[model samples]
Target: MHKLLLVMVLAAFALPARAADPLPRATPESVGLSPERLARIGAMVETEVREGRIPGAVVAIARRGKLAYFEAHGFQDGGRSKPMPRDAIFPIASMTKVLTGATLMSVLEEGRLSLWDPVSRFFPAFAEMRVVADGNPDSTVPAARPIRVIDLARHTSGIVYGNRGTTPAHQLWQRSLGGYSRMSGGDFIAAMAKLPLLHQPGTTWEYGLSIDVLGLVIEERTDKSLGEAMAERILRPLGMQDTGFVVPEGQRGRYATPLPKDPVSGQPQDVRVGLVTPGFEGGGGQAVSTAADYIRFAQMLLNGGTLDGKRVLSRKSVEEMTRDHLSPEIANNVTLTEPQLTNFGFGITVAVRREGGSDVLGSPGMFSWNGAYGTSMWVDPKEELAVVFMASTPGLIRQHYRRVVNALVYGAIAD
Candidate 1:
């Protein structure tokens, strides 16, 4: 009689599920992610939380097609103005390159563009390119080779952000006050054409407006704007609802504030709203996304360009997109020499699986990149893992979050 009563009591409490714990499997034990390790990651990042280095941050990691861990720390704004939510929107800065690269790869699959095709073939301005001789501002020499789409993808096209020493190209941009940093499509192409090339094509790796220029090339070939092409080819296909150059009116509330180092002024908030002009030309720097939204895109790449039954790229194309395309000699200049980092692949930065570089359990062929506004992500195909870290602050502050998160996520992989 006593045993039967106990069974009935358990059934009564379990069957009438309360809203508090409706889904038991959503818990760590049911999903297989070690809660202890997840807590450790939170604790590590919390150190920054206490120091007030950032207003807030969101970190999400996925393994084997499942969300292994998702957590938020700190406030979405300073003074604990708003609690950080998991679905908060971030500008995603140059992390836009990954999506832009994916769009190019899809176009390549459709035979609209070839990696080796010279940019001049599509844009006449690239026809008479010249390299800045001896780093001289006025000196110029003809390019030994043509600028190829592949070179742009790998950032080996000799294009750099700021020439730093008043080179011809640099002076022209400064003189014109041209917005190469944010320019897109035809105008962007025109501005680049008027300026001199920084170096011979494929001669060195420098991070600059290469991807933005590639966005123009896509526009020229497709005859449609970069926004439309990316929407039809990449965003819609991935079901990345929140991923776009502009945020919808109703969804604008989800976007987080972007600080400009003034803790009290609160001057430039919500970087996505008024700063980035919404159009086809902003593809390289205009994207806004949430952690959940980007994870789907990353997972698609991990799953051979298909996610949730949506196919975006062929297996061969995916492999080609992630492979390192730079020559070994030029790869050394890809990242800052002080960082002493890895090489650059076609559209993504490659981590050469060094034994001592990062103790994380990433695959030898892992490739990923970050945005200028503190958004960083990486895909380790060999390990079948994808991690996306999104935040709203700018500059090298992202380096700390990138390192700490990777250490915690990869360390808990249960190798």
Candidate 2:
């Protein structure tokens, strides 16, 4: 019986991956993972839910190109309603940047775009930009350099998230936020042009509107919306059907919401924007997806840009994306990154772990990104592993779960 089951599982993995249904399933042992260790993931999550640390969560782990562990814990509403479903959608936030990166790289593969190309090449508004002088928003100077396409991908561009600052520059950028939910690509660029950048182009690794500007570039090049272009190039090809800027009308019930309030402070937590985005397709955030849909994306990266014989990008492109594009000479490349990714370097829309410096256990080349609304995923090439953790904790609780999955998942690896 054991031989027969193993044979069937291995055979199923041989088939091409499909989107409409779950990926081929396999026992954790079949993939060289300890079943006992893998169960710890569910136990930890359930304890978190019972203790009011989180509402619910859906975790999916893939190994050897097969689904070795997939589980949902708690319910959509504090364990009152239906238990979280495997297909429940979560707003992936900045995880959306990777899809945009993949889409843009696909364009680069066609030789139509170059990382070195200046943003002004596509949007004339950026032809000349300014940099804030000595922390003074009112005093500015002409940009020392042009914002290149690569700067946007690695987030070295001077732009920043308006909400992250209080200076006049950030406030200037903040005023544009209310309109993003309905703004268009051309309008977004025009709005950004009037604001002073926080750093010179390619000077600092501050997280900001770099990808949003690149989204406009995508629209200009494809004559389609950012979501549409991504769908045609990467999402559709990889069978990420549940990923987009908004949930389908029918899938609204499957969307996860953060707790009504922070567990500690008891302050109301309204994160409606965390799950569903309407209007402008901000590449930096404002995106939604499901664990099932996103794991295929991670697997594609692990598979070196192809899955089930369908090639979305070349291996060279994926390698370039996962490598540390920053040189040691770039002063703020490692330190200035928002949230300070310990022992990690900024990759193309992802974080690349260096050889040492992180307290966590993982390979040196592992690449990952997480959303603000309690979603995280990482692909470790050395382990042939991809893990996607979904939840709507939206506070410090989200960070706790991220570490939980990282340690437990890696600990479960037996081979």
Candidate 3:
């Protein structure tokens, strides 16, 4: 009898305690946010929808590890009949860089690669890359240094986007666009190697295809496709079931869509939906996610790289990823052409507060990034907060929603 009692007691102690919920919902006041102020967020979004600016939106805010606010406004499709669902999936374009960054950090944790490793180490063709100066293809000069993995992570590799401008680099990228979406990772790297970099590596900060190159590096190091690697390293661990390169058939109804024609220009916007499995997974901007799913990703970082006891990255790695990695000149040399009032971090945009008037509202240490298709996310370590805004518009109008959301979120702080 004593042996049976002892066995039962040990078994009881051995049973794992119930795990804390990954994200617990709470009232706004319970999380130090005023419900009245948070209502303004929904109002602003509804106003935009009413004015025919955006088709729909999903906004969510979490403070001190509690979901204080969440709302779905407007319609999921271009038509106003179908109400937008809170679980609506968005084409989280460049926001994929954040996931790409986290995946690379996971690789770093496993000792598969180092930040200072040169791009040529994984793909030898990058060793022969050249730089184009004075917007002349014929005026190419050898890069001063090989593009390092850190250079790619921080956007200093001088790999500008294809549609940037009429520069020689941009023209080359535009010419190479044919193979961008269809080519394999290896082929894409080879094509990228043939084009000239916009500037010398590790010198200037120009947002471009750097993350895409890093994605290929991750594949080479892990012997897995980007989607496969991300699933194993991030999505599965974090339980972000709704985020991936392609949405399943059943989830197609929740995919958000913007107006076919621009409300202002009446020009047909190029809004591409990723319903089918992609042949090539571009790490730069080819992923879709819902607001709830992305908030879990952001919350993991805000919780010091662990969500519900699943450690995706070390706390030290999260700090390194979020800290400002730009040089003084690059951070201060703001021009009309470059990103204003912000600094670049590893795969994310770090918001910096200037002394005078600023373009957005947030804490100085807050780090965030957005997608071309009207998705925005930010993590404020100071406030222990994470906010996600999702829509489908793919133009400059998304900027207005960003500003309004930022104001409403910060303005709702009650304590």
Candidate 4:
């Protein structure tokens, strides 16, 4: 059958990208964490796998600039025949935003862009934007201010994603934007410009196509693909060898896959991304990376944008990126609906906890973010900690593990 041959052809190109060298290992206590308390994570993740919540997961933590806990739980596939590799590649969806944001900072350092630079500066299509008016699908109001580079970083751009909710505005986005993986950089921008925004630009802390637009900005400003700009600005500089827009030809064997059907939602969940190349690299959530490589990226942020003397960003830029960019009047959407995010605020492509109001256990100033496909990483400057969680599960459990991992890791803090 044609379908069968297509599968075979795709598999032929799917084949092995190994992770970069693992971070230096140390006993949990050496990094001021309790070995016994950290073992609780193993028990918790095992239960998650046994319950069929996830095909597999990888948890890696670095504190005091040393790797303390590196673990892989469950099997690589639904069949459970093969063990999950600690360095298994995963579709680190939204986690790619931080990389894109950081790359844009490199462009910023070179004066190609500025935080206040309007999106229309790079792509004029972003200028004549409209917002849904009177809560009506057919209504429109011009954005009070142009969506800026900073707005995109902090997700206040008001450009909404099509996947969530069935509101008229959401439907408009869904109907207008299709086949994104097939769109060129310019095509993607043109499609987005055609859709009305969910909120007035800079008025709402919305999580949506803002970063994806930033991706196009990166590609345009650097005159290279988003993937190439990211490699030059963050991946290569940080020595994140295994992270990229496409999983190399022979590296498909290392790609972790999701369950055939969601155990909870029962929808077919096929999150094995990064097989073929997209027409334009998506910053919203398209990169595949391993636990080892992703943690390195997180560690770089924790180290104030440098790792082992490789300066991916200046210290002050990292500070600004991690700080809370939202004011109290800014209405938070989608992510803020969660009780755990009550004490949090949006930052450049990540979330920053203002204080300790959430149910989750973490330091007061921890900055973190997760992917739709069950990947999460956080940097706690106060704790000198960076933790990366990679998995193939999606849906409700993605945020669930955000709480679970933070509790498990912070609970193990011995000092």
C-alpha lDDT of all candidate models, in order: 0.70, 0.82, 0.81, 0.83
- Cα lDDT tens digits for candidate 2, 126-160: 88899999888789999998999999998888888
Residues 1-415, candidate 4: write the lDDT tens digits.
9999998775553322224345666667766899899899988889988988878788898888888888898987766667998878888999998888888888888988899999899989888998889777688988888989988988888887776667888887887765677788788889888788888888898778788889888888889988988988888877788899899989788888887888789888776568888888999888989988888888888988888877889998888888888988888763543445667888888888887577777777788888888888888898899999988887776778888888899999999
What's the CA error at residue 235 for candidate 3, in Å?
0.7
How many Å off is the CA of 378 in candidate 1?
Answer: 0.7
Tally clashes: model 2: 0
Candidate 3 lDDT by residue in tens digits, 80-148: 779998888899998898999999999999999999999999999999889997878778999999999
Q: Candidate 4 clash total? A: 7
Candidate 2, which segments miss by more than 4 Å at Cα? Answer: 1-21, 274-277, 333-340
Each prediction's total of clashing residue pairs, residues at least 3 apart in sequence or on different chains, is 1, 0, 0, 7
**Candidate 2 clashing pairs?**
none
The candidate, 1 or 3, that scores higher on lDDT is 3
Compared with the true structure, model 1 gives a TM-score of 0.85
Quote each prediction's TM-score.
0.85, 0.92, 0.91, 0.92
As a whole number from 0 to 100, the lDDT of residue 401 in candidate 2 is 72
